[model samples]
Every structure is written in structure tokens, then in C-alpha cells.
Target: MHPHSPPWRKSPLRVWLSSGISSLFELLNAANELFSRPRNLSSPRTPR
Candidate 1:
């Protein structure tokens, strides 16, 4: 068997953990943008 074989690699748990962390950050950022501002058509910037 070779030293750099599949058996020497880390398990799937590590991959899942890293993916979850990154996804969580993306979700939080999207939520922050969604809640931090209000969309209004009656504002001065609106077109008549």
C-alpha cells in the first residue's frame, strides 16, 4: 500500500463541518442585508 493512500486522509466529518460553517456565515450575511434595510416605493427616490 502507498503511504499517500485514501486510508491516510481525513474522514467525511471534517469536510461536513467546514462546509456547514461556511454556509452558516453566508446565511447570516444574507439575513443581515435583508433585515437591515426597508424597501419603500413612496420614498423620494421613487419614480412618479
Candidate 2:
């Protein structure tokens, strides 16, 4: 049941890769949100 072997021995690899990719996307999206919007720490930095 080696990962680099035949497809029949890749079930764990498949699940691992899919979950890793999904979490990677979630992290990226969260970072994008953090930078793309301004948070109201104390005063709103909106335009005057």
C-alpha cells in the first residue's frame, strides 16, 4: 500500500490531497478577506 505505487493503493493519498487542497484554499481566502476590507478597530476609515 505504497503511495507511489498503483492506483488501487491510493485511497489514503486521494483523501489526503483533497483535504490538503481544500484547507489551502480556505487559508488563502481568509487572508484575502483580511486584506481586502478595513475593520473598525476604533474609528471607521471610510472616505470623507
Candidate 3:
């Protein structure tokens, strides 16, 4: 294997693990955003 070539690219297990981890991070981020703020639905927008 060439030193510059990515070893993970050739492995199915590594790819699945990496995608799972990435999806977990995305889920965490979405949960954080959902829990962090209260949306203001009553506020009127001012036209500029």
C-alpha cells in the first residue's frame, strides 16, 4: 500500500464504522440545537 493512499478507503468495516460515528455526531448536533432554544412564533417581521 502506498503511504499517501488512505487505508480506510479499502476496508468495508472501517467505512461502516466511520459512517456510524458521523451519523451519531449529526444526531447529537441536531438534539443540541433542538434543546438549546425556544422559538419566537409571535414576533412580526419588519419589512425593510
Candidate 4:
């Protein structure tokens, strides 16, 4: 087997893993945004 074949074999796996990670991060970001808004709304940040 040639050296180039190893890289080709792993490229699909790398792409799959990276796409999954990106999707997970997006979900986490959305969840954080959703959960953070209510806390800010419920808490009054005005200094008495």
C-alpha cells in the first residue's frame, strides 16, 4: 500500500467527526442562549 492511501482513508472519518462536533457546538450555543435569556429577564441588574 502507498502512503497516500492512509490519508484518504482517514479523511472521511475526520470530516464526519468535525461535522458532528460543529453540530454539537451549535446546539450548545442555542441552548445556552435560550437558558441565559430567562435568567437575565428574571434578575434585575439595577443597583439600589
Candidate that would win on lDDT: 4
| Residue 35 of model 2, lDDT score | 68
* lDDT of each residue in 15-35, candidate 2, tens digit only: 898999999999999998876
- Per-residue CA lDDT of model 4 for 1-48, tens digit only, reads 545666755798889989999999999999999999878876776453
| 18-37: candidate 3 lDDT, tens digit per residue | 99999999999998877654
Q: Pick the winner on TM-score between candidates 1 and 4.
A: 4
| lDDT (CA) per prediction | 0.74, 0.77, 0.74, 0.84
Model 3 regions lying over 4 Å from their true place: 1-9, 39-48
lDDT of 1 by residue, 20-44 (tens): 9999999999988776654543455
Note the clash tally of each candidate. 0, 0, 0, 0
TM-score of 3: 0.52
- Estimated TM-score for each candidate: 0.58, 0.53, 0.52, 0.59
